[model samples]
Target: MLFYTVMKPLVQVALRVFFRQLEVRNPKRLQVPGPLLIVGNHPNTLMDPLVVAVNRRDPIAFLAKSTFFQNPILKAIMESGNSIPIYRRQDVETGAEKLTPEQLAAQNEAIFGRCYDYFDRRGTIMIFPEGTSVQERRLRPLKTGAARIALGAEARRNFQMGLQILPLGINYFDPQRFRSDAFLNPGPTIRVADYADLYRQDPEAAADALTEEIRQRLEVRLVITRDAAEDELSQQVERTFGSHLNPDDDPTTLYDNFQLSRTVQQGILYFEQHAPARLAEVREQLSAYLSELRQLGLTDEALESGRQRPGTRLSRAAKATLRLVLGFPVYLYGAINNYLPYKLPSMVARRATKDAEFVAPIMLVTGMLTFSLAYVLQTMLVHHFTQDWRWTTLYALSLAPTGFYALSYWNNLETRVHRLRALRLFRREPARTAGLLRQRGHILQLLGEARAAYLAARTAQRA
Candidate 1:
C-alpha cells in the first residue's frame, strides 16, 4: 500500500514527462463495488501489476508465482502490494507418468478451494491466464486456474454472490522497455451465472468457455500495430505447434482439441472477402488475437514454406548492394537508439523488435557513457569541495558499466537470451518478398487447409 502511495505519483510524473500523452480507459469500472476478481493477459514483467495499481486506490491482491516470494526484498514488495502466493505442487519435468489421476484431481480441488475462499470473502485478486508474458500480441492457452477460481467461487456461493471477474487486457507498445506505451483495457465483467452450473458439472469445459469469451473480448480491445496475412497465419500456427511435432514419429490421428469451429471459419472467410481494403487492419487484429491465444499455451502446427535460392554472381551482387544501401540506416538508427528505452518517443527505438538480448550491448554502451559522465561530475565535486580524488575514483569505477555487467552476467544474461528468442519470431518478415498478392493467395490456401484439417479431426474425434 505504501508502495502504491509513492509509485502512482511517480509513474504519473514520469509518464507525463517522457511520453507525448498517456491514455487510460475503464478507470472507473476498475472500482466495481464488490469482491472483484481482476483477470488479465500478462504482457510485461513487473509492469503489468503496476499498471493496474496505478488505475485504482484499492489494496488489490494478486497471485504471483512462489519463486518471487523466496527473495526477502521482492517478497516484501509483493506483500506490500497485497499479492498472494500460488504454489505449484508437481515438478513440471516429472511428466504425466509421475502423477496418478487421483493425485491430479486432489491438487485441482485444493487449488480451487483456496481461490474460491478468496473470492468469497470479496478479496480482490489479479490473475494472468497466460501464466507468463509473451509479446502481448496473442494470448497463450490459459491455465485452468482462473476458471477454477471463478467456477469454484460460483459453486461455493451457489452463484448468488456479488463476485464479478473483470477481464483486463494489458497492451504494451514495447514491453521490457522503460517509458513505453501501455494500455490497461478492461472488458465487461463476467457474472456467477455465466458458468456456475457448467462448472459444477464440468469445470474444465466451463473454464475454457470463460477463457474463450475473454479471448474474444481481448481481440476487440487490445490494439496490435502489425497485421498477419493468410501466409502469416500459417507461420503463426507453425511457430505455436512446431515443437510439438516429432520428426522421428508420425501420429496416425490428428487432434482438434484447440481449433476454430465452422462458424469461426465462415466469419474469417467473410473478413477475408474484404481483406484487400481491410487486410492490413484485419490481419493485425487477427495476428494479435492469435498471438494472445498462443500465449495461453495452445499448440498449433507451424506453417511450411520454401526458401528461395540465391541467383547467380550478378544477382547476388545486386542483392548485396541493395541490402547494404537499405540496411545501413536501419541498423545505424537501431544501434544509436539503443541508448533510449524502447518505450521512448524516438521512432528508432519503437521500430526495433523488443529483444532484451539485443538491447544488452546497447545498455552496456549507454551505461558506460552514463558512468563516465557521472565520474567526471563527481571528480570535479571532490576537487572543489574536498581536494580528495580517492572517493570519487572509487565510486566512479565501482559504478562503471563493466562492474554492472559483471554483477548481472549470470542472471540477466539468461533472461535477455530467453526474451530474445521469444522476440525472434516477430522479427521475421514472412511477406517481405513474396509480393503482396502472392503472399495473400498463399495465406488463403493455407487457411483453407488448416480449416479442412481442423474439421476432419473434429468429425473423427466425435465419431
Candidate 2:
C-alpha cells in the first residue's frame, strides 16, 4: 500500500509520456464506487495494469500469476502494491514446491475467499480474464475464474454485495513502440446479482453465461482481427493513406482510428469470402507497391507529393529547410545531453527479453532509471562548476524539454531528408517518378472502388 501510494503519480507521468494518445471513452464509468471487479484484455504485459490504474484515482488490487511471486524481491513489491497471487496449474507443476492438483485447488479457493472478504469492504480488484498476455489484436478464450469469483463473492453476501464488473477493452495502436497510441473502451457494468437465479439453478452454467457476455462486450469494443494476413493488410493501408481517407479524423483521440482499423479488417474479411480474386489482386499490388517504395527509400507521402505543383512543393521545402538549419544547435545540445538516457532503455530491453509483449514495460522501467540518474548526475556536474543552485535547477529542468524538442527536430529532419531524396529522384528520373506516382494513383483507385463496394455491402447487410 505504501509503495502504491508513492508510485501512483509516477505511473501517471510515465503513461502520459509513453503514449501519444490514450483516450478512455467512458470517463464516468470509472467513477463508479466499489466493490468492482475491473476486467480487461491483456495485450501488453505489466503495462496494461499501469495503463488501467492511472485512469482511476482509487487503488486497484491486481491479481497476478503465481510465477511473478517466485522471486523474493518481486514478492514484496507485489504484496505492497495490493496484488494477490493466483496459482495456475502449469506454474505449480514446474515450481520448486511442485504442488499437487489438490493443493492448487485449495490455494485458489483461499484466494477467492480473500477476494470475498475484500468485496465485503468494497475494495476494487483488477483481473485480466484472458489469463495470459499476448501482443495481438485477438482475444483468447477467457478463464472462468473471474466470473466464478464474482458469483462466489455475491453469493457469499446473499446477492447484496452491490458488486459490479467493469470490462475495459484496451486497443494498442502500436504497443511496443515508445510514442504509440492506445484507445480504451469501457463496457457497461454487469451486476453479479442479476445472475442470482441462474447461479442458484446451476453455478457452472451461470459462470459460463456470464463469461460469454463479458467476452461479447469486450469483443464488440475491440478491433479484432481474424489472422496475421488481414491485420498486415489493414496496417499497410492505414500507414499509407489513412490521413487521405479519414479527412475528418480527430487528433485528440484514437477512437476514429480504432473504428477505421475495425472497418478495414471487416472489409478485408468480406472480400476474402465474397470476392477472393479481388482481394488477392489488391494484396499483390499493394505488396509490390510497398516493396518498390522501400527500395527507393521513399514512402507513399513522396509519391503523392510528386503530384503537387513545383512552386508549392519547393516553398514548403524551403521553410522546412530553414527551420532545420536554425534548430540544429539546440538539437545538438539536446542530443548530447539526453542521448544516453534515451538510447540505453532500448539497448537494455533487447538484451533482457525476446518477447514482444514485455519489451515496452522493461524499456519504460529502464528509461525511468537511466533518465533519472542522468539528470541527477548532469545537474550535480553543472552545480560543481558554477556552484549556483538556481542555475543547476534551471539546467535540470531544461534537460527534458530539450530532449523532447530534439526528438521532434530529428523527426522533422528525417522527413526533410526523405523529401529531398524524393525531389532529386523526380528531377533525375522524370519518367520513373511519373510511373511511381501513376502506380500509386492506380492503387488508391482500386482501393476506392473496393472501399465503396464493401461499405455498400456492409450497409445492405445491416439494413
Candidate 3:
C-alpha cells in the first residue's frame, strides 16, 4: 500500500488534467466507512478504477486479470498497489473452446480468500461486476463475482463483518475523447447481513438474487441506450439542442445533464413505439442538416451565431479577438514546452491498441511517463543553463498551469474561428447561408413538435 499512498495524489492531479469535468452526485456516499466494496460499470479500462479510487479517502484494492501478472514490471506494481489477479476463460482457452460450469471456482478460491482476509482488516475493495470493459453507454450483463465476493467475505466472519456493497454508475459523456465529462452516480449501500438467511439456505441462489439487486440499482443511475442507432440520435440531440431543452440545467453538478440524457433516450424510445415514421423523418432531416453544415464547413453554433443581434455580436467578436491576442504568448510558451510530452502519449496509444476501452488507459499511462520524464529532463537543462535554482523552480512550476491555459486558449480560439467562418460565409454566399439557416430552423421546429406530441401522449397515458 506504500505504492498506493505515493501515487494517490499524483493520480488525483492527472485525472483533473485528463477530464474537463468530473462531477459526483451525492458525494456523501463515498465518505461511508470501509469493509466496503465498490461495484461500478466499466466503460474505460484502467481509467475506471482510478476515477473511483481518486475520489475516496483510503486505498482501494482491485481485482485484475491474471494475465497482467505475467509481465514482471506490471506484477510488481500491482502487488505493491494491493491488486489480486483471477484467471479469465478467454485468457486460458487455447482454441475455439470454452470452460466447463463453474470452471473458475478452483482458480478463484485462493483469490476469494485473499479478499476475505482484506475485509477482516476493515479495508475497501473495488470490482467491475461486468467483468470486462466496453466503451459504450449500455451496461453489459454482470457476472456474479462481485455479489459472491461480498457474500463470502461476510460469511467468513459468520455475517458479523458489517460489510457493505456500493454500486456506482460511471457515466461518461464521450469515453474516447480527451477532455470529456464524467459523472459518478452512486447508489445506496446494500447491507450484506440482509442476505444472511438466503445464503445459509442456498448460496448460489443468494448470489443470483444479490446480482439482480445490483443490476437494478445500477440501471437507475445509468443512461442506458437500447442500441447503436438510438445512441447516435440521443448523442446528436444532446450535443446540439440539450441546453435549449434543459435551460435551467444546474451549473454546479452534471446530474441535470445526466437527467436530460436519460429523458432524451426515453423520448427516442417513445417516438419509435408511437410514431416510427415521424422519428425516421426527424432522423433523416437531422442527418441531412448535419451533412449540409459539414459540407459548408460550419457547425450548429455557427448558424446560431447568425441570429445574434448586431451590437451583441460585435462586442462578442471584439472580446474574442482581444482574448486571442492577449493569450497568444502564454499559449506559445506552453506549446513549445509541453507539446512533445502531450503528443507522444496519443501517438503511442493509437499505435498500441485497436480496442476502444484500452485507448484511454494507454494514453493515460503513456502520458504519466512522458510528462514526468520530459519535465525532469527539461528542468535540469534549464538549471544547468541558468545557474539559479530559484529561476529553475519557477520555470518548473509554470509548466503545468501554462499547459492547461494553452489547452483552453486553443479550444476557445477554435470556437472563434468557427464563428468567423459563419460570418465569412454569410458575406460571400448570402443565398446559401439563408438556405442553411432555414433548414436549421425547420429541424428545430420538427423536434419541438415531436417533443410536444411525446409529452401529450405521456400525460394522456398517465391520466
Candidate 4:
C-alpha cells in the first residue's frame, strides 16, 4: 500500500526530525485482543493522525470528513491509508436530514453495519470525540460518536467480544513548531462493562461520562505548576478548562495545601489532550503548587520566575504570518547551518570590546567564500545525479535569485541581532533575569504591523 511505502516513510522521517522528547507511557495498555476503539483530542489535523499511525502498532481505520472523498485522487489516498469517509450533517443529501425516526434508524444501521464488519474482522478504529480542532488549552464539549459506536458493536455481538476503548493523550511543547516536544500517554482501557448499559439508557450521557473519565485520568497524570495569585490561577483555569471556575469558593490548591477540585482536575486532563509534553497541564499544576508554597514562604524565587509565561514581542497577526511564511525558512536555515561547518572560531576573543573598530571586509569575504564553496558542491552533486549538462545548468541557474534573497534576509537579521545585543550590553540589563511579562495583546499588534509590511513588500516586488 502507498501508506507503508511512501506516506509512512515520509511521516517517519518528518517525525524523527521534528519531534523530540517523545515519552510514551503504558504503551501496552493500547493492546486489545478483539475490536478496539481509540478516542482522543484533535490538534493539528494530519500531524496528529500521522503521529498516531506511525507510533501505534494497530492498523487503525479512521472516520475522516467527507470532503476528502470529493477528489478522486485524495479519496484513493484516504482509502489506501485505511480511512473511512463519514458524511457530516451538512454534507449529507437534503432529503436524508429530514428523515423520520425509522428512516434515521435505518441509516444508522447501514453506516454502523460497515463499522461492525470492520470490528468483526478484529480491526482498530480511531475517532476524535471533540469532532473538531481547538487551539486553546481546554477541550470542547465532546460528541458521543465513539461511545455510540462502541455500544453499537457490543449490542450487535451481545457483548460476546466487547470493544475495548483506549484513551490516549498526546502532549506537545510548541506543537506548531517544526521541531518540538511530543509525549504520548496511554491510559487504562475502558471496558464495555464500564458504560455499555449507560449507553442504552442515555447514549449522550454515557459519552459524557466516558469522556470525563478519560479527562480525569489525563489531569492526574499531567499537571505542572509554580507560585501565582488566586486571580491568575482562576484565569488559567478558565483558559485551560473553557469552563467557568471560581478560585475563591473552596479554592483548590495543588500538591500539599493546594486542593484542586474534581472539575478543575478534569479541565487539566482535557488540557493535556491539547498539547504534548503536557506543558500547559504541568504549568497550571506547577503554578498552583508553587502559589501554595509561596503562601507558606517556601517556594524558590529563581525557579518560580523560570516557570512564568514566555514573553512574545511580536503581534498575533505577525506571529501567525511569521509562523507560516518565515518560521519554516528560519528553522530550515538554522538546521542546515548548524550541521554545516564554518571556519570561524566558536568563542569570541576576550579582547574584542563593544567599542572596537568594525570589520566589514572580513565578514563580507568570509560570507563570499562560504557561499562559493557551497554552490560548487551543490553543482557537482546535481551534475553527478542527473548526468545531463543542461539539467545541471538549469538547477544551478535556479539558485541565483533565491540565494540572493536569502542572503539579504540573513544579513538583515544578523544586523538587527547585533544592534539589539549592543543596546542590551550598553544598558547593562541583567543577563539571566530581565524584562516584564509579555502581553498577548501587544504580541498580536506587533504581528499585524509586520504582516502589513511584508504584504507591502511582496506587492511591490510583484509589480
TM-scores of all predicted structures: 0.49, 0.98, 0.94, 0.52
* Top candidate by lDDT: 2
Tens digits of per-residue lDDT for model 1, 165-199:
78887665444453334566677887857787687
- The predicted structure with the larger lDDT, 1 or 3, is 3
For candidate 2, the TM-score is 0.98
lDDT of 2 by residue, 196-314 (tens): 99999999999999999899989988988878887899999888878866778988778889888888888888899999898888898889899988999987886677668999997
**Which of candidates 3 and 4 is the stronger one according to TM-score?**
3
lDDT by residue (tens digit), candidate 3, 1-463: 8557688888887888788899888999986898999999998988888888888887899998777777799889788777888777776564333445377666788789989889899999999889888888899999999999999999888999999999999999887777888999999999998999999999999999999999999999999997888899988888888777778998787899999999889988998888899889889888888888888777899779867887998999999899899999999999899999989988998899999888888887788899999999999999999999999999999999899888889899888888999988888998998888888778788888987888888899999
Better of 2 and 3 by TM-score: 2
- Per-residue error (Å), model 3, residue 181: 1.5
Q: After superposition, how far is residue 297 of candidate 1 from its true place, in Å?
A: 40
- Output the lDDT of residue 25, model 1: 65
Residue 351 accuracy (lDDT) in model 1: 51
Indicate the residue-level lDDT of 216 in model 3. Answer: 95
Error of 2 at 13 (Å): 1.0
> What tens-digit string does per-residue lDDT give for candidate 4 at 1-463?
4686666765565466445445566667766555888877765555566677877766788887666677888789788888886655544545323445565557656767788888888888888777775433345566767777887787778767667888777555455443345666667788865676787788778767877776665555433332234334433443433222232443221221122333344333443454424434345454654454344332132222333334532343245445446645744454353323232311121123221111221222233445457667877988999999999887677554454344445555554444344334324634421321122223224333433544565478799
| TM-score attained by model 1 | 0.49
How high is the lDDT of residue 28 in model 3?
92
RMSD value for candidate 2: 1.1
Candidate 2 lDDT (Cα, 0 to 1): 0.89
Number of the top-ranking candidate, with TM-score as the measure:
2
